[model samples]
Target: MSEQSVTFRYRMSDRDVFYGGGVVNGARSITLANEAANRLMAKVFQNTGHCIEVRKVRLYEPCFAGDYMEFMARVRKMEGNRAVLEVRSFKIIEVPENPPYPSSIDVLPEPLLSTVVQFVYETY
Candidate 1:
């Protein structure tokens, strides 16, 4: 079978929030990203007698509260039972609210959040 790439997007919710008084934490994003990447790999390797494992993961951007985050994964290199997959996370910021200043303010990292995960798959 030929190697293929898969992508998946997940919206940020109270459960995915990390720090800034959110339910989730920075490390939570890592777990979410890893799970998503594994799911994508499973879809691509279905019926191919292969397994997937993450090798490396890096966080580039921070997803803030009330923002939509998207994840994209692609198969970069494949050699025998091993394959490298790259995953990126993007945050969609929402429009600011108007009117009086709020008592509490939530701060988060700027720009989009990105993560690259490598996986190794073996066929039986």
Candidate 2:
């Protein structure tokens, strides 16, 4: 299979938060990673890839509103039609008072969310 990947940067808006504060739902993080993985399926695997299972999941912290979220994915391993994917999630703390307007997406020393997913597929 061809190696296809993508990186996404997103700011959690009001719609992404429901706690009446800056806190974001965990589902959003998972969605970000899932979306990346799905995109790889179509782009690299030609729509023949499917996620047979989620091997593992880990949330290091809560994502708040105004925080920048970055999603990254790649095909870690492939055997026949099955592939293992590694998806990484990073959350950037937003500082409204920062010099660069609302926030910045500078790479930080850590991440708020990280996940790994397993996929199975058939490719021509």
Candidate 3:
């Protein structure tokens, strides 16, 4: 097990909206999680790793365009050449409703957990 971790922050744009109401697709979280895992695995193993399986995934909240998200990944355990990574996604900021200004945004006092995923990877 390694205590190493990585964080990726992104702001959803109109391009990220997948459906009506600016709702982003749930699959986007998976993609972000994999990215976080890739970065973290490289730091932990000193080599690239390929995701072999997504052991578990849960989407707890909806993400919308204009949402600022944070993705984090940590090395949980390792066996031989296989490593397990835990990834979490959070919504840290959101666009305000009926904003008086175009750039109006609200930062959540407590980050909202949007997704959680467990990924298994094979290190080179």
Candidate 4:
């Protein structure tokens, strides 16, 4: 079950919003990206003796606040026990806002971009 591309879509909740409070930052764009990669790796190694672990993770873009985020993962290259994955997260800010206010606003915060992360797998 090798996947060249994987996409995960999720919405933002109040918990996901940070308003100068301690909420541990629920599900955000970065989290979604990591989860997408993990899910992709899980699919790639499904039922196989090989298991993958994220060696490094970085954000190339900053996830905006109050926006729906989508993470896309693509398998770039694969070696014996190492694989390179490219992931990009996009935030959609076209959702309608509450009434009795100003004009349409782009609540979507700047996406937390990330570079390609290399993952290593161990097989026995």
Candidate 5:
């Protein structure tokens, strides 16, 4: 790979669920993506690196308790001492529930969160 990357899966549990519903908190979803970003930043941090901020963070769907989330991060661009990475979280492993379609047998869908994060390496 030309750019450093990482992928991992998380099983959302009751602790991560939001109030009044099985809905996973948006903050938890962001953290999921951030974990991946941290990996990429470490790979490029020959200098003192820190995540400046995340930009264009978007969530398309509600992740719920018992959903298996897949997280991935890849460098979108690196210029000078700054690197931008794209992070995404997807609901992969689903379960049986009130079936419009059988959740147990349904195919995993697209990403639920898409975000771009900028990491800066301080040169002194």
Candidate 6:
């Protein structure tokens, strides 16, 4: 089968900040990647499969509250009922430092890559 891909987007909320300086927890980014992988699995297999293993989660940059995050998932390979997927998250927009107002936002010239996650899923 040809590879299938999916994308998911979310706006980081203040509640997502678990650490100081409005920084979001790394697990939150992993959760977003998993959600994207789940969507891809459901689209490709017509069922929501279980994630059997997470091969790796590489963090390239930090995510912050008020950042707009984009997650992309693509099938890497498939064998029988198991499939391997790779997910990446990028920051599309961010709250600028020392903004004039609290709600000010800036769109990045290019998406800032935040994380990459690879996992294996199995359909029942």
- lDDT winner among the candidates? 6
Error of 1 at 55 (Å): 3.3
Pull out the clashing pairs in model 6.
Answer: none
- The alpha-carbon lDDT assigned to residue 81 of candidate 5 equals 55
**Using Cα atoms with residue i matched to residue i, what is each candidate's TM-score against the true structure?**
0.65, 0.74, 0.96, 0.58, 0.75, 0.95
Candidate 1: where is the Cα deviation over 4 Å? 1-3, 21-24, 47-53, 95-113
Global CA lDDT of candidate 2, please?
A: 0.69
lDDT of each: 0.58, 0.69, 0.92, 0.56, 0.67, 0.92
User: Taking the tens digit of each residue's C-alpha lDDT, what string does model 3 give over 44-70?
Assistant: 888767889889999998999999999
Order the candidate numbers by TM-score, best to worst.
3, 6, 5, 2, 1, 4
Between candidates 4 and 5, the TM-score winner: 5
Better of 3 and 6 by TM-score: 3
Candidate 2 lDDT by residue in tens digits, 1-124? 4466777787778788867566777878787778888876677767745667787777776777677777888777777767777778777555353447544545556665644444444444
In the range 32-71, model 6's lDDT, one tens digit per residue, is 8999999898898888889999998899999999999999
lDDT of 4 at 97: 46
Q: Which segments of model 4 are wrong by more than 4 Å? A: 1-3, 19-27, 47-65, 94-124
Per-residue accuracy of model 5 over 34-65 as CA lDDT, tens digit each: 77777766665543366665666777767777
In each prediction, how many residue pairs overlap at the backbone (N, C-alpha, C within less than 3 A)?
2, 1, 0, 16, 0, 0
Query: Which is the better candidate, 2 or 5, if ranked by lDDT?
Result: 2
Model 5 residue 101 CA deviation in Å: 17
**Residue 112 alpha-carbon offset, candidate 1, angstroms:** 2.4
Off by over 4 Å in 2: 1-4, 96-124
For 47-104, candidate 4 gives per-residue lDDT tens digits of 2233366665555543334456677877767766665665676665524446355434
Task: Tell me the deviation in Å of residue 120 in model 6.
Answer: 0.1
Backbone clash pairs in model 6 (N, Cα, C under 3 Å; residues 3+ apart or in different chains), count: 0
Q: Root-mean-square deviation of each candidate, in angstroms?
A: 5.1, 3.5, 0.9, 5.2, 3.8, 1.1
